[model samples]
Target: IKPPSTESVAVLQQVPIKPLTKPLTYPSLVSVVEFISFGRRKQLYAKCPTIRKLEERLPYHLERVEIETIGPGYIILKFDNFSVGPIGAYRNEISMWCPGKRVTRSTNLSLYEATEKFALYNLSRPGTTIKTLETKYTPKCILNCIPLTIENYVVDGNDRDKWIIRTTRPVKTLQTDFIIRHDTIKYAKEVTVTRPSHLPIRIHTDILSEWNCESITIERELTHVEVVDYCRKVSKRTDRPIRSVFKSGLGGYSTELFQMLSRELNAKKMELEGFFGNLIQCATIYINESTELSVLMMEPEIWIEVSTTPPSTVLQPIKPLTKPLTYPSLVSVVEFISFGRRKQLYAKCPTIRKLEERLPYHLERVEIRTRGSDYIILKFDNFSIGNFGSNNESNGKIAMWCSGKRVERSTGQSLHEATEKFALYNLSRPVTTIKALKTNRVLANETLIFLDTPKCILNCIPLTIENLIVTDFIIHTDILSEWNCGCITIEEELSYMEVVDYCRRVSKRDRPNRSVLKSGLSGYSTVLFKILSRELNARKIRMTVFGGNVLEFANIPINETTELDVLMIKPGVLKIKVCARRTAIDRAF
Candidate 1:
């Protein structure tokens, strides 16, 4: 007689859910994701054999319900959206089921109910249509225009009225040539994709027909539950009673559950001790957290195989730098810019031209000397090997002199070295060099000091070096220490229109005399004075301030031929005043 076939058992569980703050509405869909775990039962688990309907209305309202089998012990359930027809027109129920063994201990752990909202623009797909609406009940607003199909229906029929009210609520809208795209939901039967079994199987194929082994015994101790179950199964088959023998002082299983386990373990032990011990074999081993402590003491060796060949390397082309390359000795004085890649340095002065002429040379070494509190002296020496005076047996002599002083002495080096050294040292001198120079007339003429504040000294460069120097002149005075004290940190609200009108008045006068405006005084006088001072400096005119608001202007011409000195107070209050010069081809106001 044939052995009795195994019977699949059905397990029904009522999943618990908190009542919604408000009943779910559509075109909203319900999604149920359930994770069911199976207990230790020696049975080959398969896909849920039957689809158990839990709750229903008239016809099947559930669509797209799905189940996925996890790693031998778990199964996942995903319910379908409630889109059968117009959301409020019909009624449907949430129902679902999955297969499990009679000895299986299933749970509704991690079961969630989520309401999904669909786009209003997504109409019903071809072949699938919504049920005809009853004459007594009619949808309002945009819902009236929606096609009767599962894809178009979103909210549930019982809750559609509320959802319609919310959708029709007044909101600001703007007309535009723009449309937003959204994902469309189709009214189709739930799709089922075939998947491979997660159950671990071991096949023994030899000279005879192949047979499968159902269990895998790892190199670790079994628990009491496992021991009892093993003994019960063995007793039923062999009709023998055996007691567990503990291997250690601790009360535990004395030996492995199966003989193959011992043989397999011994084989691994020998392999680890054999010549091929380094050979890698890949595998995934499963164990419980509580068994982790025991597994650690056993010192199991598991191999995780990796790719023997290295990954391919990709070669990328290197890009050329945008700026010109410079040596450590060369300073980035000026960048020659053009439309694309062309480079050109426009030498507008004699000093700049001299430096540009020596651009192709390399320097041996250079030094900087602070002359008084204003001037900087660049000492260029080229006495080193492979330079100008190196081949000549002549002892290096003073090549140049400034103000009867021994300026540059070449120690048997090339002119190239001396020239390059001079150019680089001038460009890259430290700020300390500028600070060491005293604030005197010579310094004021030789260096352009870009001062944003009393404490903040921006740059100190040679007046002749047009690249970085600011085109502004200075008047020297030993006293007047608190000129910048209480200076406005923020922009002063001096009337811009007043400044403009003042510029116009100055430009209109045939010979403007000393003028003063006391009422409209504002801060930012330092910045404003700089603008006016810059204009006077460009014209080589001098201004002297004694006390009070008295300003003495020197060498200002009324016309083309005649010249006279005049004084004025409260100069235009911005850098733009320099651009609005009183004497220009066009009106500057």
Candidate 2:
């Protein structure tokens, strides 16, 4: 009876409980999406299509996202910052590429299923914006499913021809790790291809040859044969009037091409020697007076460069009293353009770089000066043109000033990273003459980009130097053996064996243009006379404790000359004069 009364009492009052929160508004729904666990979001999508659409419609901002279909179809969310990925199939896939505080819980979905579900839930709608989308060996099905606005698209080894960069606007930067699609390149303002060290980004040379981009850089070293073939394409690239094509070589000297260029085009033939690192030269092969291919051999690699003279000269002015200053007639004037202006033109865009390459410019001085450990300044013509150092205002960017005006910048990149761009541009600038290039140490970026500062200078140097004077720099035996200059004075120390080796190498050189090894080294005081007399079987060498220009007439005492070929040996430094083997000293006295 008591229980029945208690049950009847409950019926007198009916209590209603309301929802703790109301129906989420659109903004509220987005806010919920933001804080909701990725696992719960996936579960919500798994339940109904409507919730999936809602998830997609609400904006989910990501700095970067990487989708890799090649390995179990992995979709790494918040890849740049709050990483939550390698989602598991058994709700316990805790393994993450990023081991940090911000971790996403794993779920009961395989990588393939999780990737698809994430794409459907997070990427299918209109409000998703991935600042940078990285796809690695992703299949076409997944690529098609990923319908989001990507600002920058990075493709890495899409082995299945899934090379795509679908963006709302032209991709800011298309970074292709190895495989680069010809069609995909036109969709980007700048295209950079970084291939694995062992593999070159296999691409159609013709397609890349005519690419007109803000900047297009492909890190591929072609074989000598491929270089010639590429040059052939650039030669026939008449549609765009390609001024030149610069390609790095695999460090092979194509002597046949050199000979052909020299003979057919009436060009100077150069004999390559690996005295220093590789035989170095700036030899040109003229297809005609208008079109020429420059083959430069710097240690470690050969560079294939083509400079096609445009339809008209770049110096003559149109319709003037002395010479008319019409805009059309200023083509030849590009040859006389200042180094600063030429550099600016090169940095502008691809088309301007092409135009700037057609005419050779002379740079009085290009100095790579390091101010402390942090800054690397490239000074030109005795002016503080640019520095690759970071300062407060720069915000870790590179600021370049041309003629007292800030022309351009390297935004959001380290000093080492920015140096590569400048090195690439500097290597292509048609600088026929660099009076002096000074650098204390070899400059390489942190990434160790292929063309370091030292390599760049070596490639830019012309075959012949006017008056070469190297001071405070370490000069080696190779330099003494190979330098082709009018008057050479090297403030370098060399042992007696080095001086003797210089003559031996000189004697071994088969090239017709031979330089006489005449030098005065302080290293070989009285010792050189004894060694030379022993090595050369000298009839009579004056007993001078300090010799002067030791073995000036080579080790052999050739009586062909009146004065004895002297070996001037000092004590600390070596002063070497190398010229065409002329009337060398004879030990007639």
Candidate 3:
């Protein structure tokens, strides 16, 4: 049914949300004055004229102006042709209803009521003039309502109906807690803070000092005495007192001068005059007379200065000390005798002379005979005179003689040389004879003989000689005969006979006697008796036993026996028997 009268729906207009802009600029001087004189107590000064005109036309006493399209809740306001300070400069931007609001704008309602009562009573009471009235009511009300409190109050001179007020509520407590965090930073220049408790505060005017300067942070409760003591210690460390040691030497200065000076300098004011007087006296003495000389000579030297006089000395006679003699009588005499006559006697009676005289004539004869190099035969004549020469001819002269195969009168060579050469050719050759002949005519009678020879020539004599003779004969029949005889005839006849006779005599001496009584005879007696009987028989000495048991050799008794002769015993049993020749005799059994 409405289609015959169709109609249009109405659309409601949506208002644009505008950012709230704070009034942070000063108005023109004329406008500010006019606004203060008028009753516009809550007016804001915009920096821009257009923003200020638009804000003045608003119906509300409190208004926000947005001058640019920055974003929601952000603004740039301009009023009175000046720059806007910053966005969010107004007090209303801070949320007073935030959960953790640090500061509040509202006052205590109870305290505000009490304060109003006090102010109203004080104003209406009598005798309360301006002079007697206290300003406590104004301070109390401001403390209660901080945000709405009037910062400046003025009375109007022309318009008695109007009162002027200026108010400011800090948006934040100077943003003192604002902190800029950083990492890895080094500061080259000094940093300063105007107010250390207020961030974004005017720096130079308030703080005006270098940052990070070294300083001691003492607690507030430290006493003045403690601070003074601490400062004294620090001053001591920073500034040390000078030390000087004074010694005496310069000019006539002595140790006393230094002592006086030190005392005067260190004395208290009350005592300074006394110490100074003493110092002056010391200085005067040090500068006077020979005191300078003493100081100059103060160093040690070889010359010693004596303070006392030397004592007198007395001379006395000197005596030498002597020691008694310790010589012994026996020792003195023995030493003298040994060095005098006794020494001479010992020299004359030495054993060498006795030994020379005591040696046997045969050894001397052998030594003299062997003293010369001559194969000579020495012989003794009938007169026992010694002589020798190299000759095979027989001479009838009877004297000691020596002969050789050859003789050299010029070179003193003889047959001994030839014989020695011959023995050298045939080592088995035997030495026949050695003789020394007289050569010195002056001593020929007493000392020289055919046996006398030079001592130098005796050392070469060979050991093969069986017979050696030294004689003083010119001719000897026996020697001649012996020379001619052959060795076999000599060995078989004369030598053998001599040997047999020697053996017989030795046996006889060794034999024992058996004729003695049985009790007196030892076991050797029978053996010795048998040996004697055998030897006597071997010698052809006949013996016969008589009835008296006497052993008779050619009717003579032989009793003595020789030593070292072995006796043989006949092994047989014996029986006691008795026989009688002239008388009965006992016989061995």
Candidate 4:
């Protein structure tokens, strides 16, 4: 395999979750382009109730924000008591932007006070930071911004015409639903205003124009490859490692991407616009994930940038609107990388669980080798195929590896047979006989017996066999009444004490007067009893010489008009008792 494309390779692992304890650092202004595109308007919406509430309470002081938690749908931000003295005497107030809380302010009388208070108390101490947005609005913002910037970059062979529109609205925002729409794009076509609204006065270009600020228009266009290359450079400035993100297949500027970007921007105390979400969406879809952005760059007059609105709205010889830039492919490279070797193995191995279960110990490794046309040898580690002797090292030696051991066997033989022989060999003299054991059973000519191990109750022999052919004696797991010496038959072994104890336990656990034994218990005990008694006041069962024990039969249920009969032919010689009932069981002679 050519090692699959880089796009198909998923991130081998995610960075372990460690708390980012350091105070947030701000990125340079030149790095802002990585977070937002100059080609379009930008916005981000935060729906987390905590974020929305914090938006109302938090005052911005032109300081970087930091995250306390970042997982799934939850995020928290940490802040300290505010001081604005160090910022400078001229700068009385500073503004910081975040989702939902669009603008936050910190105020100080002098530079000394601002700078002294500028160091937040919580930045290095125990605190909270909302690292991610918990809302539906952010994803929508990401989706919608793509089209607004589509005209700036050519897609495939299509070129865009017409001058862009610049709208400046009032700075004083009212608590009303402000919805905006664009006709061309598929995603993020509309944006609904948030509740307890705070509109950014700075972005209200009309209000900002009245200030002493100078108007500057910077326009430039780059090829698709150039844009991707530029993103690589910008990633360093943004501290996002944008190239790796694309290679790992999380390239699309989806809501998730925007969320990450917002976290970075927050940590850096960077300004963010509503359409930055869209700008990221466009960069992720066009430049990063696809070659179309590069293809667009190859054509002339494709890459266009006019950051500041020109003095004359009608100054340019504008071309008519051509066909809109359409992104035909939305499949993200992230998908391809996420399905890695683990997923490939999952697709191949349907019975992997069964294979794991068959191992005697925790399987450290497995080597599958093809033998003949149809056969395969699976050699597994972390288990021993045979018993270890005094001379052998403790490292789970195989039977063949154990020199001069009593249970030495050929490794080439069937694993099941070898294991069975070894187990039987070990149980020879001092070990308790199977007849004396209560919970163990002998299988396959006494070669293998049930042995209790520390980790599990049912431990398999060192070998696995499927469909072993039986040459003698049929084994029956059901209840049996008779024993034949000539043909060996097997069932759950029953003893006198077992029968007594089972009934006693059931009586104590269930309704003692009328208890019902299941079929499994009946099979295990090899006897089904229906006991009847007329003594309502008798707490203990009345026993007869013929009955095995009073306690065992006492718990066994019997009906009204039922009789228990015990047959004794001679002294100390007893036969089975037959119980008869009018509506229950028939009498047996």
Find the candidate with the highest TM-score and give its number: 2
As a TM-score, model 2 comes out at: 0.40
206-297: candidate 1 lDDT, tens digit per residue: 20011011111222223434433332332223211111111101123222222222222211111122221121112111122111001111
Per-residue lDDT of 1-589 in model 4, one digit per residue for the tens? 4676655555543446688798434344223323332111112113334333323232222222222222332223323222222122235554333333334345643332332233232121122222211211111112222122111111111112111111122111111122122122112211112333243211222221122111111122222333334333433332221222111112221222333332232211112222211111222222221221111111112221112222442244679857643332212221122212222333476744343222222222222222222222222222133333322333322343211222343355444334444443322223121211122222433343332221111332233321121222233222112221211212223333443433333322312221122111223211233221222211222333222422233323334533222221221222222123321222111
lDDT preference between candidates 1 and 2, better one: 2
**Each prediction's whole-model lDDT (CA):** 0.25, 0.52, 0.24, 0.25
Distance from true location, Cα of 565 in model 4, Å: 38
Residue-level lDDT of model 3, residues 109-129, one tens digit each, is: 333343333333322322211
Where does candidate 4 stray beyond 4 Å? Answer: 1-117, 120-398, 401-422, 430-589
lDDT of 4 at 209: 16
Listed per model in order, the count of residue pairs whose N, CA or C atoms clash below 3 Å is 20, 24, 32, 35
Estimate the overall C-alpha local distance difference test score of candidate 1. 0.25
Over 4 Å off, model 1: 1-369, 373-465, 468-473, 476-574, 578-589
Question: Which 10-residue span in candidate 4 carries the lowest summed lDDT?
Answer: 150-159
State the lDDT at 44 in candidate 1. Answer: 14
Error of model 4, residue 395, in angstroms? 27
TM-scores across all candidates?
0.15, 0.40, 0.12, 0.16
Model 2 deviation from native, Cα RMSD in Å: 26.1
RMSD of each: 34.9, 26.1, 66.4, 35.1
Residue 361 lDDT in candidate 4: 27
